[model samples]
Target: MIRTLTEKEIEISGEKKIYGTLARPASAYTDEKFPAVLMISGSGPLDRNGNGPKGKYQLNVYKELAEYITKLGFITFRYDKRGTGKSEGDWISTGMWDLVDDAELAFKFLQNHPQVDRDKIIVAGHSEGTIIGTALSERQELNGLMLLSGGVGNLHEFTTYQRMLTYQELKNSKGIKGLLMRLLINEEKAETKTQKQTKKIIESNKDVYKILFFFKQPAKWIREHFAYNPRVGLKKVTYPVIAIHGDKDGLVDPSLLEELSSLVKGPSETHIIKDMEHGFRFQYEQKSMVNVKKMLKVLPSRPLNPDSLGVIESWLTKYFKADVSSDIKENA
Candidate 1:
């Protein structure tokens, strides 16, 4: 029988009031508690639904995952970033440490929830969330961890890698826009500019940096992320861990999945799904940062890659059994 799902608004108190949503199956035993997954979103100003500022990024990744996991009988909690949605604080000024604090509070909230199985709670972090989750695991004990679209590298290393790839894309462009880009951009010069900007962001004490006196960049966030290494915390994880990445992902290197698997001391597995992008959508064209951004324009109309979901489901069931049916153990 298909299970019915339920959802409700949840508020978590941190430096400011953090707004979120909790999802679970409707049917339950009198004394039964369900395994839970506390979702941490990737970098930037995102909400519980995994959307970005001004509805520009309407990628409903977390919302889709919550419903999918709830059907398998696990309660999931996802919250808005401080300063975005209904949460308190200014997102532009919120640093990486600030996000980690909010995630820690979310974890504690799950631990005390009446219907949640405290011992079976898992953290499912996506992209930047992977960094926050790994750091949190080093400080607290969790049943398992699911790292999605994240690597075992510092923000600086990843950004450098991304810049190289985006430059390659610009070099291989075939259209008039590509011609203009090729003529206007010098990779060597761009790298120099990037290095200078990185140095400025690292040295500056300001929360935000204004470029051309109009565009604002999160200085604190960049500095903190550049300084923290996800691998350091991954080394301390003794619980079951699963890392997933899309081979077609343009934002993050998929090879990082191997490094993630090797760093964790406990039982772990890694999977790289084909045709899946960073946003969890299947990409039909060549995967590039430019194409990824273009695809985001229609993210709402796309479906989450089934292959990626299958990998996650298989891994979750293999180690942490959920309330799937009478035959499966509720907590394993």
Candidate 2:
């Protein structure tokens, strides 16, 4: 039976009131103090169950995984990011550091719980959450980490891939595709606009020149992300890590994740799901609603193949057994 948990809230770095849920398994009360996982959702104003204004699959992916993992004998804690769901804060104004700290609050909460093993705390971060959580694994006294569909390339490269995909969409329908291409591709000014700003042109009346010109100066948000690199920071982590990426990701560069696995020369395992996308969908179509649905869908270890939640489930299982690895290896 899925036991409902007492809700909790905390003030994040920017004073955002973030809310969370603790899914207490029935076995936890009887078993050896269980290994607890802190679930961190990706970007945007996501809720504890993976629902958000951003996009489809609203089945509470993280919560579903928690149920499955809890049955496999683990405890789970998940939460809403600042400025979304029951939480109160401004999403657009936040930075990477702010989110990392916000997620850690849940771990700290679990640490103090009587049911949790003081030494066994796992952080399972999906998408953007992976970026924040992996960076944090270095600092916190975590037992292990699970990074899913994480973005790892430098901001500039990732944004370029995003821009091309976005422009390709606009070109698909707009008869003025040639003209727009010229405005964006050859122009030096277009280099500065964030992908979000460039996308707004589809709905806004702003001229292409103005959009491209804004890129000439640089955006504050871009500056915030450019200086914050997940791969570089994650290198400091000494904890055992389990990371996986879908083969068909639309938002983040698949190479970004592979790069992270390559760079984290310590205890890390990387899995590339053949058909999955950024949201873990087997065959994903990138759209506002599609993204919403994908985010809500449970990433069953491996897309289409539930047998191998990759090394994540097994890694947590072993770590809790006290055989945590200090040597890293990548699995295909």
Instruction: Give the top-scoring candidate (lDDT).
Output: 1
What is candidate 1's lDDT per residue for 1-332, written digit by digit as tens? 12577789998876899999998777546466889999999988889999988867888899998888877778899999998889999999999998888999999999998888888999999998888998888777888999888858767777787888998888778889788878988889999998897788779999998777888999999999988988888898888998888877887876677676678889988888888888788877778886766787865687899998898888777777775552243333
Scored by lDDT, model 2 comes in at: 0.62
Q: All candidates' lDDT scores? A: 0.84, 0.62
Report the alpha-carbon TM-score of model 1 versus the true structure.
0.93
Off by over 4 Å in 2: 1-14, 28-32, 54-59, 154-156, 167-222, 284-311, 321-332
Q: Show the lowest summed lDDT stretch of 10 residues, model 2.
A: 323-332
Give a tens-digit lDDT track for model 2, residues 1-332.
22333233433333566777776545323334666888888766678887766654354667666666665556677777777777776665566677777776667778887768878888888877776776677557777778877656545566577666655555454458656755656323445554455445334432222444544322333454556777776776676777777666666666665665566655777787766656554544444222434444544333443533545566766677522111111110
Clashes of each: 0, 8
TM-score to native of every candidate shown: 0.93, 0.71
